[model samples]
Target: MMSTSFLHPCLRRMLSDRGGNFGIMTAIMAPVLLGAAGLAIDYSNMALSQRQLQESTDSAALAAATALASGKVADEAAAKTLAKDFVVGQMTNYAGTASASAIRNATNVDITTSTSSTSKSYSVTVATSYRLGLTPFMNLLGHSTIDISTTSSTTSGTSQTRSALSMELVLDQSGSMGYDTNTCAQYKKNGTTCKTYVVKIDALKQASASLFDALDKADPQHTLVRTGVISYSNGLLRDWTNKVTSVSAMDWGTTKSRDYVTTLSPDGGTDATEPMQLADDTIKKNANSTDAESVAHQKKGNSKVDRFIILMTDGEMTGNSNTWNKDKDQSVRDKCDAAKTDGITLFTVAFMAPDKGKSLLQYCASPGGNYYEAETMEKLVADFESIAQTATKAATLLTN
Candidate 1:
């Protein structure tokens, strides 16, 4: 009944009115949108500042811990002041003087220091709090400020044993030495290959002796060094035995100890796992006991002594032709893990291992434990020395 035309003024007016409403709505919301962007920028800046402060505080705490490890400070006040000063000084210089205001306003830093169970070590904790900058947009969103915090800790200890060392030198006497491989061609100075008389096993033995000599020379105190040897091929050539000849039953001092050697005659199958297990056992048993050396070193307040195992193998884990892979000898790994749980350090040395075997040897060490691969007698000798030094450093830091 009501007539309608294709173009109508009423319809056009309705469309125009909607567009006006949209414009009004956008005007009302524009500030809110801009404020949100500002808020995002503020939050990002706060996060970055928090991260920087945390890093600075962490470094400070570590430095303080090292200083405390010297055993020079006796009281808590001294320790705290030392830690705070170290942390503040480091952080202030971290970014130069120009950023001093930025650092101060961005974070609140604190450091706490405490002595170890033994009076020789110190533990430090660093904490930092960052106050968040409010974004203009965030104000409309109801957040005035945001706060972030982070904390970190570290420990340092001094060396109490003057000539402390735990060593296990393994010599390989496998038949591989009978036939000179292309690899052995280089060690020969003259036309004759060293393999002709001194086989691979003999070279290894010499290297082991050299390592002992180094240890003897490095010993500062005559009564402090302890040494062991494990030789393996088919079965364990040697058992878990301590120093063949201990110089003196003294503690905390090195003694002129006789060098010991355990040589394996190449003849049987190869089971590398057994030797490692046995060496680990020997170190654990000796460290726990009050031997002449331990008795001499006992003090009023000191942490429990630690043991170490240095295992070496020339080939992959193979013997009896039944198993060459390490997965089959998980029992050995379990034992090593148990020793580590008991606080024994484990190191592994591999000779002439392929890629796969090398990784296996490295894994034999506990996390962050020592793992070295040596192809020649010289490298093997060097590996032993390095392992000895690392163990000494760790022991000093832990016992001091």
Candidate 2:
């Protein structure tokens, strides 16, 4: 690496060097390669921002639809306000390329209703378009900003058919979660400090908090949504068990799970079996009693209640060597199978993990959007929010 990297300096160095054509090429292409890499990073950031926008839109659409179905939104104007407000709130909570004011201004919401003899339906659409600023590399290329837009639609059927949900977040709080995801030196400050880097645990906490908030917007009364969190490193930290529910159906709402995640101090080796089993049991017990989760929804005439488990990990199962443990890995898979057999939906995330961990998460996932492999902290946050958005759409997703 050259200390002075201007083109003139590189040419001068290349000419005087006995390293010859190869060194000259290396010196010349070095800047171009670095510039190209920077541009790629900018494009990747743009992609993540757009994806976050889409997810926020999706959540907005669902929240508006739920409000309409629950009679909280009286008319089309109210629906629009609800949708815009929800999305703006989410964007405020989770920073994106587009500012909250910009996102709110660019967003559009449309609602249409249909009524049959015994049923009512409301179709809601949410869309947003904004200009995202790019990095200096893109500016040098004469592209300073990119226009991005996203749209999502949801339909709310009769209240009697809309289902409720009981969700559990099984998080891995192994020592690795305390590590940082900032790889490129260009994005760092002069001094290396705790405040300068993005830790994986902090990223999870933020993403999980956003997920809870979006769900709250969908079910403000907490009657239709109940979420819980349980983390395991070497095993479940006994001291933190009382803070969040491990084997309860109606324990988490907007703040309970967030509180637990916010205080997570990741340490020790990774052992995820115990918590995953507890989570599976806590939410799956609904099958015996028609789902205690569906009780409030049932009072509102709902008959279905879906169960979800969001399992996230940064490493494969651990053994004495602290690397891979096949038997324990299978045990986790067995728990996944048991939960899925009980009709529980699983959303698995492998964040900054090795191939073995990714493979394990892929196996635990329920196919399609259920599996997320986040190589960056930004993607991890987006993936968790996506999970929350997708879950709420179950009762309202329309194909026709």
Candidate 3:
């Protein structure tokens, strides 16, 4: 309370001696500041590690469950091996290339697999310790590590299985399909230069082959997949007619559909109505057939058949043979609508098609994410593969 001027010189010297105050304060508060910084850094690392662990376990569990659902893994031991392999494979980013040793040292991994008459399930738990980077403060606190863990489970089998799929692929083989594109190579025929062109048909063949391969992979047992091929130009080709073949019965082990595609030669005009109607009729007949497969599926209480018509074309509808007074484009749309009304899902692809063709196909496709436009052959193939995977329900993700 006394004024500064009234204080004695010695008292003033003692009160104003602040040369070492900063060092004293730092010395006193250094541990708290460093401890806070260390906690922030270590906690961030722990969060990252936990996220990565969850991702790995989730992927492993889903993969193992899919294998079981598809009958790729026969028993519990095989399922466990698959899950562990997947988990270790996914954790490679965390442990470098030595993930095998990391997985071995992980004490918190528990894999449990169970199967019932109608379903199979895989549960995976991964718990491991991440050594904190040795910050001087954390080391001084004797806290040099943090633990991270995650658990994920997935189930699949007959109960979870989608109904048997009947996919009718209606591909366009018009004269434009024979036109040269850069996607395919031109070959010499009978010592002639064969025009040295890569036709759109060649791209279609390659893409169709890839699509069939994906379908084969999706249906390993082949009991749940049946495919019918219909190639159309001015009219539907009878060669690949109402012949619906099971995945197992195809010439190739799983890719027999490729044979039908490979044999097709393009040489006619474009018409969408005939091929669309043919595909629709084929799917309806097969879906409602009194065959053993349909009866068995009906008996299982899953009477809903998954019917799909994948119509791909490279040109506008030009002919009017099968249409009833409706324009070519309107006729195609009407058929597509009827097919949809009959519980058949439609996927329409416009590959290097004109604006008119693209618009018509867009109208024909199912409302939600069923229309695709591919300006290039590569994109066409990728789209087909994606559709095949979706149709077979091969890709599954864990939500929780």
Candidate 4:
């Protein structure tokens, strides 16, 4: 046992003092806390620089690759030069002139290009060492900067995986299509009495022609699209019966289809069942047949064939006195369901149609945005143009 009573008085007093202990501890830890803060700041700066570098590299790669894919750059040497230029330009935009210059001076950009029979590709790899803004703590730890690198690649060509389109246009030539409209008129002779009637069918013909024009413009070479026409009154017209034609077969320089449309006269009751059935039959035959034109246009291969039917009518479905014996509307609906089940997309247009007609078209169309109703002649044209654009746009497929 040690006795406190025997200790020296001055020594005991010093041991018992605890008033300045906190101040002493703070003084010892101050350097450590400050160093930690400095390291944190330096780490944040490094992270920001790394992100900037990554973004710049990615943008440069995309720009160069797009050019290569589009055939803007002829060969590998040109592509490499283009990629380097893009990187320098992008870095300059990301940082200031001084930083960009420093990065450019330190960086090495390598671009590799390869080509196959069907496609061209470009890959860009950017390597550089980034000089960090050093903190005193980081300097003490012997770390001033880090190296960052990134690689990106892109390819472009006519994709053999893309689907080709085969579209059938089934138009109504019902008596109602001859009704007066404010936008267009046609003259008809009845026993020397020439009557001028503003006709919906005339507007339909013009709009349909515009659609074909758009298709031609989208596919100038006539290699991607094929079309068939079936105009129906009481039944499919004998003149246009099974009149399916490919773009390659048609003379692109002439308006042969449009001219054929101009000769169509509106008569007889509207029966949509026959037209829908005919479209279904045509698409099915095109899909599986060994005929030369069918094999060239619609045959299954590495690519697929997209079958579509565009049904346009201005009146409700009426039972054909010559053919249909059951409920006409129900018969049409049944055929529509069968078409969809067979993977044939349907685009239904009702031009100034009654409620029954609109509802039927809506049901017949492929659900979710396939049905279009045009209240006027102008709208009919716009609808056809929109459909044409959609079909053409969907034909292009981009892959990475």
Which residue ranges in model 2 land beyond 4 Å of their true spot?
A: 1-160, 183-195, 239-249, 285-291, 294-301, 319-321, 397-400
Cα error, residue 397 of model 4, in Å, equals 1.8
Clashes in model 2: which pairs? none
Clashes of each: 13, 0, 1, 0
For model 2, state the Cα shift of residue 317 in Å: 0.5
Expressed as tens digits, the lDDT of each residue in 1-400 for candidate 2 is 7755568888988889775788889988876786798689988988888888888899999998888877787877888998998888877665653587888999999889998633678899999976777887766667888888999999986733346788898888888888887733234354554345777888888778778888988777666677878888865666554553332234635567777778787787777788888887777745456655555556655457788999999898894257688888898889899889878999999998999898988999997769998988778878988888899988544322
lDDT of each: 0.58, 0.79, 0.71, 0.72
Ranking by lDDT: 2, 4, 3, 1
lDDT of 3 by residue, 1-400 (tens): 8677756887989998889989999999998899989888877777776787778777777776667666788866677777777767767777566546666466244556666533556555444433334456687688765556667766554345456677888888877888766553555676545547667888898888888888787666665667767777876644466553211221212355667788777776778787788777766635346744355446555455677889999988886342222377788889999899877889989999888889888999987898999988889889999888888773332222
- TM-score for predicted model 2 compared with the true structure: 0.56
lDDT by residue for model 4 (1-400), tens? 8788756887888899898999999998877787788788977877887787777667766766677667788866676666666666776665666676677666665667676533446665655555656777766567665565555554444333445677778888878788876653444555444356458988898888988998888666666667767788876655456653211122222255566677767888878787788778766533456534357664334245577789988988775543433478888889999999878889999999888889899999997688999988888999999988888777767554
RMSD each, Å: 17.9, 31.2, 15.7, 11.6
Candidate 4 global lDDT: 0.72
Q: How many backbone clashes does candidate 3 have?
A: 1
**Alpha-carbon runs more than 4 Å astray in model 1:** 1-163, 177-198, 238-262, 285-304, 322-328, 395-400
Q: How close is every model to the real structure, measured as TM-score?
A: 0.47, 0.56, 0.54, 0.61
